[model samples]
Every structure is written in structure tokens, then in C-alpha cells.
Target chain A: MASIKDVAKEAGVSVATVSRVMNNRGYISKETRRKVEKAMEAIDYHPNQIARALQRSQSYFIGIIVPDSNHPFFSDLIKYVEMRANEKNYKLLICNSLEDPEKEANYISMLRQNQVDGIIMCSHTMNIESYKKVTFPIVSFDRFISPNIPCVGSDNFRGGELATEHLIQSGCKRLLHISGPLDLDILSNRRRDAFVITCMKYGVAYDIIEGAHNKLTFDYFWSFITEKLSPEELHKYDGIFCSNDIVAYALYIYAQQQGLQVPEQLKIIGYDNHSFTRMLQNPKLTTIMQPSDRIGSMLTNTLIQMIEAEEDDPHVNNTTVDVTLIKGDTT
Target chain B: MASIKDVAKEAGVSVATVSRVMNNRGYISKETRRKVEKAMEAIDYHPNQIARALQRSQSYFIGIIVPDSNHPFFSDLIKYVEMRANEKNYKLLICNSLEDPEKEANYISMLRQNQVDGIIMCSHTMNIESYKKVTFPIVSFDRFISPNIPCVGSDNFRGGELATEHLIQSGCKRLLHISGPLDLDILSNRRRDAFVITCMKYGVAYDIIEGAHNKLTFDYFWSFITEKLSPEELHKYDGIFCSNDIVAYALYIYAQQQGLQVPEQLKIIGYDNHSFTRMLQNPKLTTIMQPSDRIGSMLTNTLIQMIEAEEDDPHVNNTTVDVTLIKGDTT
Candidate 1:
């Protein structure tokens, strides 16, 4: 509750002298600085940070915009980014867009208005053109927006191929692929395409079941799986590839409820080797590891580099981390 | 890249007039406002927020500190808080403490230095005394630090009683409870107490299994479950209550891998009805549903109320929401 004037009065010095010492902006003797420090400690005087930022012209904050934080993938990404940002002595502001473009745009403007140093966007709902008008630096994760902006992601195509080949090598004949909403050109779509091609190369029949677009709800996923896979059709498939582990785990539970034997009647695989896979009732999910933590750190490092680099430089390349298939009991 | 000088020239007004209009701090005629707007659009001008913030004392931003976003409970909480904060015309800065007291303390100082108006803390690692030095208004979630500060959480005792009574009614003879980190005295301990007392009432033998301390990691959980539950112990206990759904899922998978029949031989229940629970291999988790989204909104609303209240008379309260018991095949 102590103010600068109170500290100055206690130190027996002018308020300007105390201000100079606090801001480190003007010359002050060591004796005067010591007196001010003693006064501040005695009174438990904490400077008003809001007033300090006004003088510095920098908030020293960054914004992270995610589609949905509840999704394990984005949550893991946020953790890594926050860790890296902390290391660089920057505070992170998080905005959840919930896959709504209007919300995403609003957050972008809000971050700008709050004077954030830069923004890292994980939501693809907003238009790239809108971002072109932004004055601050932007780095996107798992999304390709503009040619000028940097993006970070895993090699989805290769990951898909590896998962499909693993299933085929395990003697899976007829396969089914469950994917996320198909509208966004996320790297995940590339994996889906590679999955189909890999299945075709092995002379296996494959079917695709598309979940509701951008609908990450559990109920929606359950309804989608039940409506797509009937009891008779379920018996015809020997392999199942899910876009993410959450869906694969759901499929596993639904299959068990229907009395179908796992790995014998159906082999299930998923993307994003989330912690949930290891905690499942069967621990039978075979999934592709997306290296979420590494991707998040790399993206933060890259964005920092971009912010520090000259604006006209064009040498930086988009980053794509590697992915590997994790074989589990389902395979 | 267009500056205020350029806009002023285009609008045939003085630079001071343009600045006043942009900040909305000074009187301006309707015609002048319209002219400035047209000039800004014509030149595609965007204000440099950093430069503008230097003129104002506050940054118009709030800080949010959480344990980890990857956890479904925290993710849902972050989403609701962000939504409510956005509606109130404030931007959110997010920090992940990773359940480390040092990291949590560091984030608090960083946010303070960055000039955030207030902070919403969901991390429970740091000591309550550490927060007394903070000058900004802080609202804690799920953890009570001091009587003077406002805290928000669900009715832990009631929820614990409901979960334990449900298990007892299911006719379980022997039970085991898996808990989160033990350092923080919050909902988990309350649940543990209720479980023991409820089991004692029925003359059922029960034991407590401390899964991990302070930090929840997959490696810690995997080893804890495997080491604590030997094949012999698995048959002795017919029911298990996990502090959180994540631990419950891990127990389910570990039990299944050891060839144990769930519900038939062993029943498992968890807290925090996360989306991942429905995605389990056998739907083998009956859990207590904590209203995470509601908690987030309620916390934000309370903080905003405190922030806007008269500085001389800040209000503080300890509020507890309700929790529901969700039934599933696991029990």
C-alpha cells in the first residue's frame, strides 16, 4: 500500500531521486540508491507495474492462440511452448479459439491491443489475409498460412505410411480409417492420404469414415463411429486407423462393448502417441508419435529467431519434425 | 507501416487530434472522427499498440497460471476462463507451472513485471506465504491460500462422500484408493478421507496407494501401478478409487495387460469425467464429474468483481460448486 512519495519521504530525498533509482534512467549516487532501497524494503513497497510498463513501452508478453486446449495434442503443445517461453524470460498469454474464426480474429486483435511482442497461432479458422494486416510477428503450428510466415509440424505423410505398413505387415487385410473433420488442410490430411495409398500398395481393401468437421466432442465422435460401423461391417475389417488416439480409444471401447475380440477381430491404430494410449484398459493402441513437446519448443525457438531477424530476410525454412510409429498390443 | 502523422495529413488534421481520436481520451467532433476513420482505411493504417501502451499506465491484460494444459481438467478450465475473460473485454496471458513451486513463483514475478492488471492462479505447488508479497489482486482456484484471498473450488467433502458411498453401495468388500501428489492439501485428500470413513462404516477392508507425489507423470504412474499392485494384491481388492481419471485409465490398462477382468474381478472408479474416459478400451471407468468449465467461469467472474470493487474495500469469498457421480460399466 506504500507509494513512491512515501518511500521518498522516508528516505529524506526528493521523489525524482527515488524515481531515477527505480527506473535506472538517470544518474544517482550509491548512497541515495541505498537509502531508497532501505526505505522500499521497510515499507514493503512494490512498484506499480502498470505505471512501469507505460514508461518502458514494452509489455514483454507473447500470445498463444490454440483451437481447443481440451484436446490433448494442443494441450501438450501449449506446455512445451510455455516452458520454452519461460526460458527466454517471456510471459505467455493463452487464447482458446475453440475452432471459431471470429473468436480467433478477436483474440489476435486483443493481443495486439494489449501490446504483445508476437503471436503463435495454432488455430486455422482465421483467414490468412486478415493476418497479413497484423503489424506483429506471427508463427503458426501445424498450419500453412502464408508463404512469408513460418510454420512447424511433424512429417504426417511419412507417419501415415509407417502406421499403415506396420498394420499391413501384421497381416491386416481389410482396413478402415477414422479421421478428423476434413475441411482444414492440416498436415493430418496428408497422413490420411498416405494411409490410403499404402493400403492400396498392399492390395488391401480400405474404407474411410469422416467424423464431423472440427467437432472434437466425445459424444459426436461416439455417434459417428456407431453410425459408420455396423455389427456386420465391423466384422469385415481387420485393421482400423484413427486420426488421433482419442478416437482410437473410443473405437476400442465400443468394440469391446459389442463383444468383439481385439487384435483378433480388429487391430486399432491411432495418431499422436498421447499418454492416454498407455493408460487404456487394454494398452493395445498402436500409434504414431508426433513429438509434440519437441515441435512446440522448436516453434518457439523459430519464432524468437524470426522476431530478432531482419524483416526482409527470406532464408528461413519451415520446420517439420520427424514422426515414428509406436507398436503396441493392438498391432 | 503508416504512421499517425500520415493519417493526420490524409485527414487534414493535426497529429495531436489524430492521437486523441485513436486513444479516445480527448474531445473530437463527429466529422473529425469520420475523417480520421476514412484516412486510416485509405492508408491501411494500424496503430502501434506498444507505442500507445507507453502512454497509458495499464496494459489491459490478466495473467493465468495453471499446472499443465495437457491435463483435460486444466484444459477445460483454461477454455472457460479465456471465454469469460474475452467477454469482459480483457486479454489473458497463460503460464504453465508444471506443478513446480519454483516455476510457479517465477511466473508470478514475470507476470507482475509485465504489468498485468490481475492474476488467476490454478497451481497449488507454491506456498501460501509466497503470494503475500504480490501486490496485484490474485484469485486462486481449488486451493485456499489465506483467509483474505478469494478461492473457488467444488464441494470436495460432498463429492468425496458421494463417490465413496456409491462404491460401498456397489457391494465391494476390499478397496484401494489411488491419489495424486500429496503435498497439496485440496480435493484429493478430502476424497481420500471420505473413502476411508465410508469403507469403515461398512466394515470393508481398504488401503491407500499413493501413485505419485507433487508431479503427475506417465513414468511415475506406470511404475507406481506396476510395483504397487502385485498379482496377489490384485485379487484381494475388488474395488479401486482413483483420484483422477488419468490415474484410473492407467490402472485399467495396467490391470488389463496383467490379464485381470475389470468389474467382474476388480472395479475401478475415477474423478474428473474427462473426454478421454469415454474413449477407454472397455469404458471401464465410472467417475465423479467436476464441472471444470463452470469453475473457470465462476472464478473469472469473481475475480473481475473483485478487480472492479472499491480499492479500499476488496471483497473475498470461499465458494464451492457441486460435483456429480457419473455411472459407467467399470463399477
Candidate 2:
């Protein structure tokens, strides 16, 4: 609980001298600095971060807004974001927006009030106007909120192409693509577009099913897929490409429950090579690895740069990382 | 960007009056308060949280240290913790210790410097001396750092008992219990104790394989399990009880690769009933479910109470939540 004044008294120096030593500003004699350091150590004087951040107008805190941390994809994203943020001596204030626009807005305001160095927007529930009006630094993930804010994501179109090409190469004549709500106008819709374009180019019949966006509950999407694609309908497709690994996992479980053969009867490919993809039995999931770690590091570095940049400096450019197709037993 | 001075100038009030209105402290005229509120709205003024926190000697922030958020068990634990923390108007600064003592110590110091109201220690790489010296309030999860610190965790013994009893009832004469490193003296060791006692009571032969603590990489533990139990040895055991769902998942993958049947030829049970457990194919994993959400709420509330309580108040008692045996196709 010792303050700078206490350290100053112990060191037989003025409070201003102690402040200068703590901030490492202005000139100070070596003996005086050594005495102050010794006194600080003797009294266990830990400088208050709040006071220092107030002076510098920076909190060294980054806010990460995600829909749900329990979801496999978000879990990985959060893990990497925290890791990279920690590497730079920054702490992450992780807020789960729960896909609520109002909640996301409130969190953004909270982050601003605390003067966080920057915010990483992994959830896209808020409108573009809110982001445009934000005075603090913000870097979006997958979704481009406005031209002012930079976004970081993988090549979703290429990811879709890789997935569809893998399925077609496996001799799948009819394909099914299950994805998130395409009406959201998010970057991930590019995957669906690529899926359709690739299917048409290959002269293959394909159908698409769109589920609600940001719906973390797996059963909701599972029941939707089952209700829409019946046993007879499912029998028509020799391949299925899910938007993410979790959905593909649900599909794999559903197929197992139905006693349907994989690869031979239905080849499956998923996006986001999540850890659970390898845990599947009989046939492991073939997936598209979205370079999550790369994206996290890039996002963190970009946000930090934006935070440290001069007020009138130009914004950082958007980043698009590449994706890889990982072939497992499913294909 | 509007400071209190701007609000005061626009409201035609003294700076002290504006500060009083913002903090809701001291008596102020109703007309003056209304004018100040209107000024704040018109100027889009957000009172600096860092300055307010410094004045109040509180940050309203809780630090959470976990081994890895990507891990299924920790992900669920973190999601619930963040949700509960947010409900109480506390933001969570998530720190991934990566099971490194040095990293954990640095995070503790950083959290202290920031004047976090409390810290939730879910990763236990630090020594008792560190926890004892933490001047801020702290709550341990799944580990007892000191008698003075309140801990919140599920009943490991009961979880163990449930898994063992289910496997025995499934007609498994021989069983194997795979667990984390038992040398860490963590509360989870109680599960191993319960397993031994339960097996003795049923006169069932059981063996155990201890893996490194917090080693999230599945291949490392999988290789160890393979080294300990060869195919010939695995053939002798009709059931396996894993300490957690993640380890059970790795075991399931190994079993599938080895061409061993689940539930019929071999019954498997896991602890923690993670989301991936039910997502497993064929014999969905039957497992024990820890009351993670309840534990999270209890931990957050207790920490907030300790933070708000008088310094002379006695420490809160540790809490142990009940566990449930969720029956699935695995057993």
C-alpha cells in the first residue's frame, strides 16, 4: 500500500524525484535513483497502474467480443487472442456478447470508458454506425463493419473451393452445403458462393441449407438439417460440406445414428479444423483450417498498431489469411 | 472524448458539482443534476473509469487465470465465469498461464498493479507463498492453494464413484482409470481415491494410467496410454474410466483406431460430460457432469462479497458442488 510519497520519504527525496524515477523521465543522479529503487523494494512499493494509465491515457487492456466462448471455434479464437495479447504484456477483457447487439454495444461503451488500448471485434451484432462512431481503436474479425475499421479473416471463398474440390475429387456426384444464415451479409457467405460456383463448374447437383447465424446450440442446427434433409433426401447426396467443424460433427453423429456409411455413402467436409474433428470415430472429419492462430496474432498486432498510431495517421489495411484443406477419413 | 470539464462548462455548474453528480455522491439540487445529465448526453461524455476507479480504490475488474481456454472443460468453466462476472458489473481479465509458474506470477503482479478487485485462480502452477502474499481477494478453482482462500469445485469423489459404478454395472470385470498427474496434490486426486475405494467395494480389478498435468496435447497423452496399455492388455479390460471427458475422447479415438468396439465389447465412461462427449459417434460417451455454472456463480458471488466485506470479516468457507452421472450410449 506504499505510495510514491512514501517511497520519496523513505529515499529522503522529493515526491517529484520519485515520480521522475518511476516514469524514467528527466535527469536523475545515479546514487539518487539507486536510493529510490532500494527504498521502493524495501517498502514493496508497486506503482499504481490506474494512475499511470490515467497520465498516459492508455490502459494496456484489449477487449475481445465473442458470441460464445464455449463454442469450439470461439474457444480456439479466444485462446489464441489471449496468448498473443499476453505476449505483448496486455490483458484481455473477454466479453461474450451472446449475439446480442445491445450487449455488444454496452460492452463497447464499457471498454471505451475504461480507455482500453483497443478492441478486437469477433462478434458482429452491432451495426456499422456504432463501429463508425467508436473513438477507440477497433479491429473486426471476418465481418467488415465499415471502411474505417480494418478486418482480419481467412480466405473464405478459397476455403469453400478447397472443400468442394476435395469432395468432387472423391467422386461425390450430389453435394449438400450447410452454412450459417447467408442473409447476414458477413464475409463467410463467400464460402457458400464458392460452393455454388464450384458445384456448377464441376457439373454436379448441389443443395444448400442455411441455419440461423450465431446460434451456438448444435442441436438446433442438427434438427434443422435432419428435418430438411430426410433419409430419402440424404441418400441422394454423396457429399456434405458443413460451414464449420461443429456442424460437421453433428452431421457425423447423425449419420452414425442412422447407420449410414461415410465416404462411400456420404463424404463430409467441414470448415475450421477444430480439435474435435480428429476425435470422430470410424471416419475422421476432413476440414478447412482457417489459420486461426495467424489471424489472432495479426489481429492483435494490428490493433496494437492502431492504438499506438498518431491520431491523424491512416488506418491499418484489412488482412486476409489463407486457409488449408485438411483431408481426413471423411473424404 | 468529452471530459468532465466539458460537461461542467456546458451544464453551467462547478467542476465539483459535476464530479458529485457523476459519482452520485454528496447532495445536489435536482435541477442541477438534470442539467448535468443533459449536458453529459449532449456532449457524449463518458466519465473516465480509470479516474473513478482510482478515487474509489476499486477497479471493478476480476482477473481469471486458466491453463488454457481452448480445453473443453476450461472453456465451459470460463464461459460461465464470464457470464456471472458480467451480471455483477465486473469485467473479466482472462489470463492464460499456460501452466507456467513464471507467467502466472507475472499475471498476478499485473492484476495487482491494475488493482483488480479479486482474482480467480483456475490454474495452480504458482506456489503457496505466492497465493498467501496476494493482497487482493482470490478464489481458487479445483485446487486448494491455502486454507485462507475459499475454493469452489465439484465433488471429485462423487464424480469418480459415479463413473466407476456405471462401468461396474455394465458388467466390466476389469477396468482402467486414466487420470492427470496425481503428484500435483490437486483436488482432482480425490477422484482417483474414490475410484480405488469403489473398485475395492465391488471386488473389480482396476488399473490406472497417470498422465502429465495440464498437458493439453492429445498425442502426448495418447502415446502414453498406448505405452502403458498395449492391444493385448487393452483386450483384457472390458471398461475404462477416464478422469475427464477430453482424456476419454482421446481414448475413444485410440480405441476406434485399434478396431475395438465400444459399449458392447468395451464400456467407457468419462468425467466432466463435455459437449463433445455426446457428439461422439455410435456409443455416445456416458460421463459425469460437474455443476460448472453453479460453481462459477458461487465463486463470483463469494469473491465479490469478500471484496466488498469489511477487512476484519472472517474468510468464507470453501464450496463443493454436486456432480451428476449423465447416461449416454457409452455405458
Would you list the clashing residue pairs of candidate 1? A93-B93, A93-B94, B181-B214
Interface root mean square deviation of every model, in Å? 3.2, 1.9
> How high is the lDDT of residue B196 in model 1?
80
Of the true interface contacts, what fraction does each candidate have? Answer: 0.65, 0.80
Chain A TM-score values, per prediction: 0.82, 0.88
RMSD to truth, every model: 5.7, 4.2
DockQ-derived CAPRI band for the predicted complex in model 2: medium
lDDT per residue (tens digit) for residues A191-289 in model 2: 999999999999999999885665556677677778877878777788999998877877876786688888678899988876556455446678999
- Give per-residue lDDT, candidate 1, residue B304: 80
Which runs in model 2 stand beyond 4 Å of their true positions? Answer: A1-43, A278-282, B1-42
CA lDDT scores, all candidates in order: 0.79, 0.84
Query: What is the C-alpha lDDT profile of model 1 across B41-132, one tens digit per residue?
Result: 79977675644544663455778898877666777788788889888876777888887898897788767766677899988888878887
The CA lDDT at A319 in model 2 is 94
